[model samples]
Target: MTRCDWAENANELMTRYHDYEWGVPTTDERETFELMTLEMMQAGLSWQTVLNKRANFKVAFADFDVTKVARFDDNDVVRLLNDAGIIRNRLKIKDTIHNARQLGKWHAAGKTMNAYLWAFVDGQPIVNRYLSMVEVPAQTPLSQQISKALKKAGFKFVGPTIVQSWLEALGILDDHLATCTVNHLSK
Candidate 1:
């Protein structure tokens, strides 16, 4: 089956992620938070690296439970920094904790990450018809707007490029190549 060119030569884990998870729409708050965290962790690193250490991240971040992670203290930060299984970036680690607290505040206000994000696209994925990976952009105007909103909302490490990737990863933006078999929009 034809896959996106980037995923074609990837390792088994990445291949599976491409086929099964990437660009799949999800409204689950936990899953949304987890994807956002993973995207943030991927800054200055490869997605493959993040995927390689995903299990460790899940364990380290309390399965991406917003409340649990928001409660992570200085001791937890130190533990994450010294953990060999995940990325040891202090900024990303602390940012994850801070972002969790922001999410917690949103939760208290009866807002959900899923709803906040999907609202950008009117609750539907923006299906793109690019014929090749080259046609896919690194960041778009929409991403920039979203990044600005997120930053204003107190999220860190969420620049436009990262926000764009996170949007794509969450299926808010479906960027699968039109020629690829996994392009559900094409089908």
Candidate 2:
């Protein structure tokens, strides 16, 4: 099947994520949290690696349950540190919990993760018409704005590039290349 250039050579795991999951708009709170968390884990790493370890992450992080992950404490940190199935980075592990707690608070305030995230682009995905991967940006002014907002809310690993990737993955910003077959179909 014709695909985005970045996904063209992807392995089975990455291929499935690209074809079935990436850039698909979701309104589910859990789903949104999971994608955003995975994007955080992807900092300084490859998407392939995150894809490969996703199942393990789900298992280790209590299926990405915001309440459970938010409740994670010192013991959880030690446990995650010893878990070889997921990324062993201390900062990432800690930040996952931190973000989860923040999410929990947001939920308590009646804010759904998907809804809050979609507000960034006015609840519509921005479909880019770039013809090539090289034309896609690593960061944008919009991304900067989002990153700033996320950091203000006490999230970590939410740099401009990381937030941009999260936005793309969540379908808040569709980055599929115009030359890519999926670009037209990605929505």
Candidate 3:
């Protein structure tokens, strides 16, 4: 089973993530929010770092529960900052809280993060057939558009690059390499 080049040399966790989760479309609200929050935490950092700390993040951010995270206070912020297992960036932590609040508003309005995001692609994943990771772009016009929309909708720390990664992680944008086994699986 040939994996994507990036995953081939990855640690066990990343290898598992690539094989089972990456590029797999999901509509679960908690999972969607979790991936988005992880992407936000990944700004200026490698995906490996995020994956490495995912377990810690899940614990620190209340299992990525939208309502729970949205209710997080400054006390929670202080707690997260002192956690050595996860990234300790204060702005990212606060933005995750802010984004969770935005999701809370969406929930109150009878909307879902899944619906709002999948709507951008007309309810289908955008499949890309790149042969190598090098062909995968860091950001694209679609990401820029989504970033603008998310920001306008009250989400923070969601710039184009982060949005692009989030989209990929959510399987809204399938970027599996053509030669990778998961490429066929995602399709």
Model 1 lDDT per residue over 1-187, tens place: 8999889989998888888778888888998999999999999889999999999999999999999999999999999999999999999999999999999999999999999999999998998979889889999999999999999989999999999999999889988888778644311
Candidate 2 CA-lDDT value = 0.86
- Residue 131 of model 2: what lDDT? 82
**Cα distance off (Å), candidate 3, residue 145:** 0.6
Specify the poorest-scoring 10-residue window by lDDT in model 1.
178-187
Against the hidden reference, what TM-scores do the models get?
0.96, 0.95, 0.96
* Model 1 quality (TM-score): 0.96
**lDDT at position 64, candidate 3:** 94
Candidate 2 at residue 118, lDDT?
A: 84
Q: Which structure is stronger by lDDT: 1 or 3?
A: 1
Count of clashes, each model: 0, 0, 0
lDDT of each: 0.92, 0.86, 0.90
Best by lDDT: 1
- List, residue by residue over 1-187, the lDDT tens digit for candidate 2: 5788988887888777777677777777887888888988998889888989999999999999999999999999999999999999999999999999998999999987788778877888898868888899999998999899889988888999998998888878888777666533443
Candidate 2: worst 10 consecutive residues by lDDT? 178-187
Name the regions of candidate 1 deviating beyond 4 angstroms.
Answer: 183-187
lDDT sort, best first: 1, 3, 2
Pairs that collide, model 1? none
- Model 2 steric clash total: 0
